[model samples]
Target: MKKRYLVSALLLFSVLSLFIGVTDLTPLDLFSLTEDQAHILWVSRVPRLVSILIAGASISICGLIMQQLTRNKFVSPTTAGTMDSARLGVLVSLMIFTSASPLQKMSIAFLFALLGTFIFMKILDRIKFKDVIFVPLVGLMFGNIISSIATFFAYKNDLIQNMSSWMQGDFSMIMSGRYELMYISIPIMILAYVFANKFTIAGMGEDFSKSLGLNYKTVVNIGLVIVAFVTSSVVLTVGMIPFLGLIIPNIVSIYQGDHLKKNLPHTALLGALFVLFCDIIGRIVIFPYELSISLTVGVIGSGIFVYLLLRSKLGSKSNAS
Candidate 1:
């Protein structure tokens, strides 16, 4: 019941996004689009909408899988250092493959992202604490170490301006040619769907999964690969849109429980909706002048993060009492 309502709300917001941009595009403009109007609709509005939807859904679902595999609700690409590692790879590309194409940069970013996420999982293996909250803190510290290194190099090369642009998430520049790299996430999302059961079982812990004859390590490696690929693609193309991953999955799980298969679609839907809502708000908040999606999501997501923290604390107290 809740899922249906959320899905409906998402659809409504998506339609609203099409009509509410700075350009005076009405419902009539969509139907009887002149060549110039068609160009605006195709080159600007449609692609932007698609990018937001893909970016939102892919990151959220990736985060959901990460949390499940680690048995930690707080784990995500942003929290777990996967994104920072990928950014490091991007920085390396800028340093070494200075003239490389975006595709080439994406390849390096994917490699580093995989390496970073693998290292994070290894760190998880070493950690004695099984508390969900503590795990992401460790990941954040780990990510900060890599970020500091990236910042050092970026500053040295006078690439801080370029790097800063990449770090901040903005959807306003998403025209037709620029945003197509995000299509890579579609196949990766499909792969995640295909491996959904394996991920769910693997999340139960290595010993339990192995007892059931599942190759736990292999399943985990596969999940990590998907996460790295998706994170790199989104981050490289759209910049870092934080908390889409953390918030969407957590919300879905609240109503749908932790069953990966059941919650996956809802996570994707809510992610798209959340990003759309934020993007629309960013567009209209200052009218013609727009806020970046990252800033909008950051402010809103941080507030939600605080609320969730309080709710979790209260729930713990209630349970104890």
Candidate 2:
């Protein structure tokens, strides 16, 4: 849980990621790399590594912010319909802008993501039965509806093949020209860190924040926007990573407490490290083949999520008894 340890692990995994591809570019080859090795290192491997780091950190932070704003340990972009809405937006672009560039596609995706997230929050406001677990369950249902609509239209328009890519996250396809869009998350994450304290205060409740002269709605809207933007950019670029955001921030809070500002860096580091570790395992699992980032993260994250669920339920039962 120490910052130094997380930093060390992230660096080590990042280094290993650089050299552990189908291509034979070990540390030994770094000294006298052939042109093809250098090209692969620069073009494919490094870009994949960079996208993993940024995407991991950004999404984890996005989840942390969402959890804070909603005052729920389980709320995250994946659970909150944010990513699903973005996927629908991407499907729309594919059907409409048959030759759209990545940026243009992301722009449309971002708007829909933001809208879907806003609607989810509004529904949360209207709902009176907000058990800690109930909120994200609602979000999951909301996401499924959006996903179903996307699938229906995709099937009719014959864009299901294009729509399928963003359904799961993968880093293998990220080359230099292909992955630059992921960098958009970097600044958005920095902005999250900058407003961390305000978010923390805002999380206390709209009334509490307003009593302190903070514009509670403004802060919450900003948080939603950041979540949507990061979610859309990551989905458009690398596809939907399962629960990287959901589990990482909760794991961090168990040891680090609930201070959003204090936990930002650690959350970011561990997220990046966790993703890198999963990615390395995915690459080497089949020796010459790969497992894709979404699959690896999904298996491991789902296990952790189950643990979190059981812990919460048992804790509640103990308190009641």
Candidate 3:
């Protein structure tokens, strides 16, 4: 019932996002668009909308898979150092392949992200932390360390401003040529859906999964690879939009339960809708001037995160009592 409501809300927001932009486009303008207006709608607005939907859905689904595999609700690309590592990979690409094409940069970034995520998984294996909260805190610290290193390099190479610009997560620049890299996430998301059952079983702990004859390590590696690839593609194409992954999956799981197969579609839908809603609010809140998707999602997602934290705390207290 709640899922239905959320889906409906998401659809409404997506439509609004399509029409509401810096340009003077409304429901009335769609029918009689000037060439310029038509160009803007087709080249800019449509691409931005598509990027937002693909990026949001991909990241949130990645987070859901990570959480299930790790058996921790708080584990996500942002929270688990995956995004930071990918960002570092982007920096490396810029430095090493200064003359490389965008496609080349993306390939290098994807490789680096894959390596970094693998390292994070190894770290998870070595850690003794049994509590869920402690796990994410560890990830936070790990991400910060990587981010710090990336910032240092950006500053030294006189790319700090460029890196900062990329980090802001804006949809305003989503014209046709610039935003196509985001389409890469669509196939990756489908791959995730295909392997949904393996991920769920793997999340049940290595011993249990192995007892059932599932290849736990292989399944986990596949999940991590998908996460790294999706995260890198989105980061390269759209910059970093924080907390969409963490918040969207958590919200979906509340209503749909944790079955990965069942919740995957809901997660993807809610994520797309959530980003579209945020993009629409961003477009209209200041009229011609707009907030970046990162800013809007950050403020809103923080509130939701706080609420989840409180709910978890309360649930724990009740259990103790």
Going through the candidates in the order shown, the clash numbers are: 0, 0, 0
Instruction: Summing lDDT over every window of 10 consecutive residues in candidate 1, give the lowest-scoring window.
Output: 22-31
Q: Tell me the TM-score of each prediction against the true structure.
A: 0.97, 0.98, 0.96
Residue 181 CA displacement from its true place in model 2, Å: 0.7
* Ten contiguous residues with the weakest lDDT in model 3: 1-10
**Best-fitting candidate, scored by lDDT:** 2
| Poorest stretch of ten by lDDT in candidate 2 | 21-30
lDDT (tens digit, per residue) of candidate 3 on 1-321: 466786788777777777876677787888789998999889987888888889889999999998998888888998888888888888888888788777777887778778777877788888886576888888889888988999999999998987886578888888899988888888888999999999999999999999999999999999999999998888888888888889888998888888999999899988888888888888779988999999999999999999988888898899999
Score candidate 3 by lDDT: 0.86
Q: Model 1 RMSD to the real structure?
A: 1.3
Which rank order by lDDT, best down to worst?
2, 1, 3
- Tell me the lDDT of model 1 at 247: 79
The runs of at least 3 residues in candidate 3 whose Cα sits more than 4 Å from the true structure, single-residue gaps closed, are 2-7
Candidate 2 lDDT by residue in tens digits, 1-321: 799999988999999899897778889898999999999999999999999999999999999999999999999999999999999999989888889998999999999999999999999999998898899999999999999999999999998888889997989999999989988888898899999999999999998999999999999999999999999999999999988889999999999999999999999999999999999999999979899899999999999999999998999999999
Ranking by TM-score: 2, 1, 3
